[model samples]
Target: NQPGEVFYTEYTYRPWIQIDLQQFIVVTHVIKRDIRTPKVPPQDLYGMYVSKRQWDFVNRGARACFFGLTENEYNCRRPITGQYVTLTLEYEQDSYLDALMDLKVFGLPTGCGRSLGMTTGDIKDYQIETSSNYKDIHQSRAMQGIEGWCSSATDMNRWLMVDFIVPTEVQGVILHGWYQMKRMFIYSFVVEFGLQEHTLRLYGEDGLDPKIFTIDSIQDVHILQKFMFLQNILTRYIKIRVIDPSNDIACFKAEFIGCQVYGNKL
Candidate 1:
């Protein structure tokens, strides 16, 4: 006996559920299960967002229907490529209604580690003056058994840049704001990715770096905020600039997740 789970959305347009495998995978298939004898059947479509040189969006929801008693399980055997997969629900009526009993994603491992930030090069401008090396965003541990990246209180122009030491294929990035400190939580920020060393220097100068991918309205405070790229990007630098710190100060722990696709660049 499985618990009946209903997935619904409010008055929203194109509401979706994006899942990050944290690394690239050869997706064999995706199985979406629905409950039987339920109030309403799960009527939603599926799609894949794969990355090559850029992001490619494709609709793979071949056939989606419901059968009584035993719910119909939708299976898409489209071998998609990418690190991040977004499962979108399409409805006939205006109201957004759907149900999900379970979801199973079958794929092969890409042989990538957990966090790439551990080996990243020097972190820049996190703190004007370092103390106890506490401002080190690359450190995994904090003082008193706490774990986080601390920023200066008055550093209005604050940013954290991650250097891969080489051009590497990046899957995604995760941000964990200081949960213990209420005022240090970040509400909004900006992300920039670059492939050249000169671009990295120009980006820090302000209004210079070309915006490869940027998201402005992030409201997740003091929690693990994640952004998965649809396609793998081979870049040497990644930066996160604080915009609306929400608390006049910004502090966080960051993780760069991906793998080295090729050997170190010369």
Candidate 2:
């Protein structure tokens, strides 16, 4: 090591999830140095990127989280080393519950955000040897059919799809859609995702067999201008289908703008 030289060190983390789909969040940063420095002014951290999050609404089966990252590239000019600091993540989207359900059948636990499910007592992640199942079709129209606009002046519709990667060892499959909303105030529809590349048996929420080919690829869902957000999931993917909802969803316009995965491995 030479004078005026600096380096970064990280403490490794081992993650485990019991649920079939896992979403966990971790906050990380550098520890203050053990040694002291001259009485120079505090230095600033540069060239680092972080995510800023402020949650407004929290509910069961779903939550309203706004994720934006704070990014910068520079050196810390401060003279202090042993002080507390905070950083952010890059998951900049309103992650949903359907995204969670998509992986419950055949996906394995992996990466960050894999442990953040609605329930805590559940396993950190789970691997399924069974085939993944889901049906998407005309019956797929949900939130759109829900009556009452949260508020006017705001119109929006969102479509989401999750990809689940099952082992090549698996065979055929069956998929289902089950929805429950404690209050219909802001909730618009029953989100659905179709399974592609894999065959499936369709079942309705009422527990009856619905003999019909749901939807083709995610594109077949037919919602408009469905902006796609980057995300990290094992081999599986989850998608949400939101209707043209009014504003006043949350105490605000309840926006489902975007989401980004950490770019971690599957």
Candidate 3:
């Protein structure tokens, strides 16, 4: 198709493109190319890209790149498996419509969804709130169709702990703030990775567990956000704490990335 023949949405409505895989599949990655304008990609011509599932009205399933495409890549920080994968432009149609030279989606047709975190494993004991489910912390969707985790108290002390049962090689962590219903998003939070020998100890007694990476401040993160460790971390336990007490509400869903290192113990 000629450059002028490229599809452009009517400015009166939101601009977005949806592709129905028709059947459910495990979406592993997505690659987008720029408009066929120059031999080398130009600066300031970049636009934000958000790969999502289902409808765009709801942001629960969104995984976005804050800025325009970085080096023309937007990998799903966490698993994004769905029947319909949608790509949307953050900015509305202005003088020019968002253009796409090419777009690609790579995945498997497993039908069942995927997650990097251990789905059925021992979790740290915590006070259960009737309105909130601790299990939702490991869920994929925020509030798209289900209620995600929300702390009963708002003292900046709320935490969600996960035990992998064995030492795992952790590469990164992806978080989804409460983007459903009232939209109680976690403005900021901190993550800590550790390893322990026994679950009965509650706390590591030998001072062996140490903090690997600290994300002390992140502002205005509403939907899916990903943080990858500088290097792979080997640990058995991972803790996420929401330390900002100003919001009066702290709610989120998260997934940890990496694989299990067989026969390895810390």
Candidate 4:
């Protein structure tokens, strides 16, 4: 029996048993724990452990749609609750395609909690948008005597590590760059981030895409966004793309603050 399954006649109640739909939500925390701190346990002392990966996000209503349950489109509903959802999260790191990252179920935390997000569905085939497609802005909107200009460092001769500092709790990050160079030379963009428990990653094999670029490296390697890479990883540092070789210098001046860590025993 299913919801709106055309109740030929009548049963005890409407086949549609309205149960709360679990809205898969994720919370994150970032910690800087150094086990080497004198008396700080042994070499096996971690900050925290998020024993659970898949969580339950409850969606309530008698005849509303659900987060994970498809087919129950409008005018229909399903039954489910208190059920631990199994997840196969896929990070949508593709900057070219417009996609929603998928089910990053759980986190085995350590040190501190940074941030996370609550989402619905199996987003295995989705990606995130990185570059802004502002191609329709009226040229008249441009400032008088303004010229279309771009600032570049290292240019195509260097690899730039594009790092993203997402506010705590933010689960998605979209990276963007240009491969406008008219060459077939090989290039690589690496994306990696880890917080003891949670993780985020994105990468690409080559760079020749003149269009959108995406990376779903956090999860799967299939489905690319134009030149997009796909990655569905649960981490505070959700985005980071770089190709800076030791020989290269001078990257685009991106605004960011730096912090220092010290070993205090007092």
Cα-based lDDT for every prediction: 0.51, 0.24, 0.52, 0.24
- True lDDT of residue 169, candidate 4: 25
Global CA lDDT of candidate 4, please? 0.24
- lDDT string for model 2 (1-266, tens) is 34554432232221111121112222233222212342234332212221211111111111212122212222233321111122222222322111011111111222333222212312112311111112212222222332222222242433333233331111112122222253222232333333342333232344554323232233312222121122211223233333324443311011122123344511
TM-score for each predicted model, relative to the true structure? 0.52, 0.20, 0.44, 0.22
Q: What is the lDDT of residue 141 in candidate 2?
A: 24
State the lDDT at 240 in candidate 4.
Answer: 31
Question: Candidate 2, overall lDDT?
Answer: 0.24
Residue lDDT tens for model 1, 128-178: 222223355444321212445665666677666666666877766676554
* Deviating ranges (above 4 Å) for candidate 1: 1-20, 31-74, 82-104, 109-147, 187-209, 212-220, 228-232, 243-247, 264-266
**Considering TM-score, which of the candidate structures 3 and 4 is the better prediction for this target?**
3
**Candidate 2, after superposition: displacement of residue 211 in Å?**
27
As for TM-score, the candidate ahead, 1 or 4, is 1
Please provide, for model 4 over 15-70, each residue's C-alpha lDDT reduced to its tens digit, 9 standing for 90 to 100: 11111112222223212212223333322211111211222222221112222211
lDDT minimum window of 10 residues, candidate 2: 96-105
Candidate topping TM-score: 1
For this target, which candidate reaches the highest lDDT against the unseen true structure?
3
